[model samples]
Target: MNENAESLSRRLIRNFNTAPTTHDVREPLYDSIGARLAPGTAAQKLGASIDTVAPGKMSCPYHFHYAQEEMFIILEGSGTLRVAGEMLPLRSGDVVFIPPGPEYPHQIVNTSDQPLKYLSVSTREQPEVCEYPDSGKFLAMASAGGERVFDVVQRRSNDLDYWDGEP
Candidate 1:
């Protein structure tokens, strides 16, 4: 391994709560927060984050990925998993797996009075495309240094001709 990789290695993260919370004020009712844990460690193949959602809030919109796969390990509290129009209860120690496909748009909603916490893990594939099944919107993304350099959201009808502007 390289010197930087060696120096960045991490064996333990004692407290997930110490990571602090983050959310968008515009999202109000749908707000959730997370701490990215693996990116700082220079993890190459996979990425991880510890997410927490307040009661009655959702973690995200119902969407499915085109290239990336994701899994979540519930650490505490209770919630509901909504996938492809199906609703399922979730609790501590639950493991949720989501593979690449248009048929599995998913989201999490905190149902109990307490905060729901989970560790989200996903494949680190770039140039990912995602679709929101319910909203008829799509997302195109390209990442560099763990930040999205190109992120676009559009409707299916916005697609342009492939030969447009071509000589």
Candidate 2:
């Protein structure tokens, strides 16, 4: 075993005794969302992280991934899962799998009066591109060899027909 692998595995086991936590926030950039108990900088380097959401907050933008796949397993409270064009009501112990593709743009919104928690797992080196179908927003990781960069674009309507006031 290499030194890097051994060091990482040791850090993972020893670091969990006191995990980092983040306060939930109502941020517009994330599209009306919040997260608590999110892994810190070190944990992200390992692979995945856990997140908690409060009531009236969304887990992420209603989006789909092109490379990274995510699974959300509810730990508490009830929420609505907007996947594809359908909304699935979810509660404690409910699990949802979002495969990597354009077909399943998924987001979880807490509708109950309590906090909801879940674990988010993905490969550390996977490249991801996310698209919000409803808002026509796109975000992807840029390859700049520096900090993670994002590209945003809005979808334009192709139908250019003019219509009168009458239906």
lDDT for 103 in candidate 1 is 79
**Candidate lDDT (C-alpha), each:** 0.85, 0.64
Q: Number of clashes in every candidate structure?
A: 0, 0
- Residue-by-residue lDDT tens digits, candidate 1, 1-167: 68755564453332466765576333666867888776456467788888889888887888999999999999999999998899999999999999988878899989889999899999978989999987899999999987779999999988899999899
Q: Worst lDDT window (10 residues) for model 1?
A: 6-15
Q: Give candidate 1 regions above 4 Å deviation.
A: 1-15, 25-28
Superposed by TM-score, candidate 1 places the C-alpha of residue 60 at a distance from the truth, in angstroms, of 0.8
lDDT of 2 by residue, 1-167 (tens): 79999877655553322565555465742322223232333455234455666667786678888877777777667878988889899988887787788988888887777876666665444355677787876666653332456664546453334774559
Report the Cα lDDT for residue 39, model 1: 49
* Pairs with backbone N, CA or C atoms under 3 Å apart (clashes), candidate 1: none
**Model 1 lDDT vs. the true structure?**
0.85
Question: How far in Å is the alpha carbon of 144 misplaced in model 2?
Answer: 8.8
